[model samples]
Target chain A: MTGQEPPKNPHGDDGPNPPDTGMGMTAVAYLLSGMLVWGGIGWLVDHWVGTRGIFAGLGAVLGMAGGVYLIVRRLGA
Target chain B: MAVQSMVLADVPFPPSVEDFYLPSILPWGEHDNYWFTKITALVWLSAALIIIFFLVAYRKPQLVPSKRQWLAESLYGFVRNNIAIEMIGPAGVRFAPYLTTLFTFILLNNFWGIVPLIQISPNSHIAFPAFLAVISYVMFIWVGIRHHGFVKYFKNSLIPPAPWFILPLLIPIEFFSNFLVRPFSLAVRLFANMFAGHMLLLVFTLGGFAMLNANAWFLPFSIVSWAMTIALTFLEFLVICLQAYVFTVLTASYVQGALADEH
Candidate 1:
């Protein structure tokens, strides 16, 4: 749209690093899925233990941490 | 949504979601019959138009390129070079055809949402976008599998460069995000855009009618509503092109990711 080229580099076989279309999606997915998956697992654990959502809360925090780690490792430059 | 046209020749007030469904064309007044409807017809029509136009336009390849050929060539060239190649690089040349078809199909279908008489997009239906997402999902996974062996592809996508203790946390997140979320988000994004755009237009257009019918004093407000509908139609046009471009570029990006040898 800028009528100019996106910069390219010689890294992979494709030469051009993928543009910014789905990157936002992948970032969001990783963040949300990390929390939801861990949080849901913790919810199940809570159901089994009959505790009052404490485990779920802990899991959400842990999952959020995992999400941030994944985002940095995978998406961070 | 074919079942939404509960009664013919009568428009509903407030334009509930029921307005999305139009009466079946194949079996006239039968409420349950959804064999063929405006949505179905529009989809088929768009497909046919694209195929026929490309074929006719390029029936005779020319050195100078006729207007039809030029238009057809530019469309293909734009997607091939801009979207496919730009996103996926040189190897993306092989993928230009599919990307072009996807762009045109979605663009046409989304364009229908703003068309005067036919103000509904087939893409407003989740099934269409979901199906397209399925195709992209399958193709990317298949490409990944082929490029990297099945075991390796899974390793590449699911196992990021991380320490072993953190592996448990990271792997599940990777699988859930890459495998599960990609297709779901792809389908939902396009469907939601078209669905919301159509709903917005419907509210503006039908709200004018509902208002005018309720009170003559509401004429000016009704006129303003109609004006808003026109303005929103232009906004819908922008959304239509954007959603189409987004879908194609994302698909190409997925392919690029799938084919990447390293992070």
Candidate 2:
């Protein structure tokens, strides 16, 4: 049997009106923001820990987690 | 350059851990390139296999299908009905095919990492996951901007409805989290999990082999380690499927967010 599809909530309430924009702008924003944070995480880890690999890894994870939280809260709200 | 020279050139390129990674069937110079080289080949092979199998199985569509056809159909319907349409809504149904392909590709690639002979997953490589992440990132951004204008998409992404005073602190963080964090997290999550799982398997399996070199008494302990490796292999299989599902589901969710009016 095929998997069941979930019913959509028609009464869903979105918070506000979003601005209209082109795909390229958003894509560039996502890409550049991620790379910058990645670099920042690396720098922060190297400065604090004096060890690069593991701390950088943790920084990346934290940065990502922080990102996901913000996006979900923003969009979902 | 001749194939022989190229192969020979790689032979002396470096002598390290890679030299130890002799695949059960050396596809000539096939496995010589990079961490994700085998991954890419296997991913392509898996795609080809899936396509061929489906074509052959459903050559003449039937109400009561053969086993192969049933398996293929089940896989298709599972992703189509469960993930794509479910997350994205009826309007999103058209995306089922692409989403289904994506799910299966990631699933096969992730699972391939733990398979006996082909012991690497391309998704475990940062590049492949990064590529997928970028694709997803582009897609969602496209969809979001198409639904909302570019300016609106940006606002929806970061600027939650807030008092003017709150903008000073919240805007940059929101912007960074939404735009920068999404794809990076996506890539790292899959990469880290797969990489760590693989490293663990290597440790257990190799440790067992290394331990066996000890006196006969220590040889028995190696069996326990091997057993753990086997158990972890099963766990890895579960992880492969789970991670693939998570990635696909998240992608669907993001796409849905793009298509829908921002909340």
Candidate 3:
């Protein structure tokens, strides 16, 4: 995110280029996880409530919050 | 009296899908259906067009490079250096071929959705997106387990270090979300957007036609519907490109994650 970019990592003895995403893989991973959380909750809620609209509305709010929380926690660590 | 009054009735312009439905084009015979019925032909045609453009533009492959060569090189360079290297690191160079092929394929198929007459996107078909997602799903999972043993990879994905109490809740969520939900969401996101977008366009475009043919009074509303249909067409182009990029970016990210240290 900074204007200053880090030098690229050197290749490992095993082959070439280490397995890091520079920003770390967590950014992308968290986004995917967030989507999954929203989708899963929506699906489950729809099944239980027998209403698609209510399921999506509530599910999105809860899913996004959970997703952000998990991502921040991971990043902080 | 009923017939005259019915003509003026507010039949909220019929949906767009009916106007552009396959029915209109279906009667055109084998030549017409060739582009629409088979998905791969559209993809192949798109890819062929790209290849021809590049080849024609850069036949000399000059060191200084002409404008066309520059454009071609820039595309290859952007995908190669920016997306692939950024996602998979320098080691990703080895996989550049696969990544390039994917980016080109998806980008072309997506563009098909807005290509005027040949307006259907191959990715709109659930089967195609599902196939791509499955490949990515298998690729990452296979790489993860192959590099680290199966038990270790599964443990790595599920049991990232956390407070002991939190682990209980996180484990099930992480396992299901990553293993079960990842592929499904990946497929559905692209599928749902294209499906819905195409349906909307169909409703507006087709409904307008159906209404227009019905009566003179119906023409004005049909015209408004057609305008909206055209706007949605433009929006659809953006969605197609964005979805393709998202799919590829997410794939690269997943692959990167598999290669990273598990925590």
Candidate 4:
């Protein structure tokens, strides 16, 4: 052992991608919550507007896009 | 099939969720009583055991080592080094005590799921995990607010680095994901695992009896079912440890997220 002070948090490790950072769960959470929140909101909008499932479908797709965007922004960069 | 009906006469073929709601202890089957139960007893026992064990283990001071002291130290070191500091950075040292306590409490509680007669985890109930999750949730938020102040902390987490045009879309997503999902998932993940583990064991153990009770021809299959139950117990052991470790690591990760500067 070098007897030096241990490296700091996961980022301090030598590996390019540290493991078990809990970011994976965070990513999944973003994706799922994104779809649920926007889609549910769209469904309510549809209910009020008296439209069919079109808005809900659009919302799910848009939310999923936002989720990917968030993952890329937060975890990727 | 010639068999003594009284041996396992009341063995319900397919175990149900009712089995988990063990009868009350305080009132002794008086019905409409929920003050004390086996689950409550196990939880209290686990807490007391940890408190006493740690107190006694570190009570004696030795430079070289004693077995109990060494064991206690190892547990603390693992959580501090591997979980707290590893996940939360240098500032995590302050949280090692809480993380270690959490790890041991969950480990012991989950262990009860497969322990011979004490075959039910207090965590199988949603209330216990929900409360634990609340503590973690409140802690990270408090830490974040204390570190960055209330407004800045909310800005730090709720507002992502994105083009201003799309911020309206992104901010809601961030709030829902970070604030709402984190605690809900934390509680559900642990409770479901323990609950399902108990249910799985109950099914196999009772399936054996159910098969034997059905007909003599199924006796061999019943033996195999019991054998599978034994193997699954070992698997349960692995799950118990993994779930405990996962919970601690995630809580530390949340704290780290709270303390992060930019990214």
- Top DockQ prediction, candidate number: 1
Quote model 3's TM-score. 0.69
lDDT of 3 by residue, B157-259 (tens): 8875777865654565566667776688789988888778877877787677667657768989999988998999989888887787777777776766677
Per-prediction DockQ comes to 0.45, 0.14, 0.12, 0.43
Per-candidate Cα RMSD to the true structure, in Å, reads 4.3, 9.3, 7.8, 2.6
Candidate 1 wrong stretches, greater than 4 Å? A1-21, B1-11
Ranked by lDDT, top first: 4, 1, 3, 2
Q: Write the per-residue lDDT of candidate 4 for residues B1-263, one digit (tens) a residue.
A: 23566666668869988888888999897555668999999999999999999999889858866888888888988898888777876678899899999999999999999999899999999999999999999999999999999999999999999899989888889999999999999999999999999999999999998887788689999999999999999999999999999999999988888888766
What TM-score does candidate 2 get on C-alpha atoms?
Answer: 0.72
Tell me the deviation in Å of residue B147 in model 3. 3.6
Of 1 and 2, the candidate ranking higher by TM-score: 1
True contacts kept of each: 0.51, 0.15, 0.05, 0.41
**What TM-score against the true fold does each predicted structure earn?**
0.92, 0.72, 0.69, 0.95
Instruction: Summarize candidate 1's per-residue lDDT along B9-69 as a digit string, tens digits.
Output: 2556666667677889888755666779899999999999999999999899888888998
Worst 10 residues of 4 chain B by lDDT: B1-10
Residue range A19-57, candidate 3, lDDT tens digits: 343234354545556555666677787888798667666
Better candidate by DockQ, 1 or 3: 1
- Rank all candidate structures by their TM-score, best first, as comma-separated numbers: 4, 1, 2, 3
- Cand. 3 Cα-lDDT: 0.68
Candidate 4 regions exceeding 4 Å error are A1-17, B1-3
Better of 2 and 3 by TM-score: 2
Weakest lDDT window of 10 consecutive positions for candidate 1 chain B: B1-10
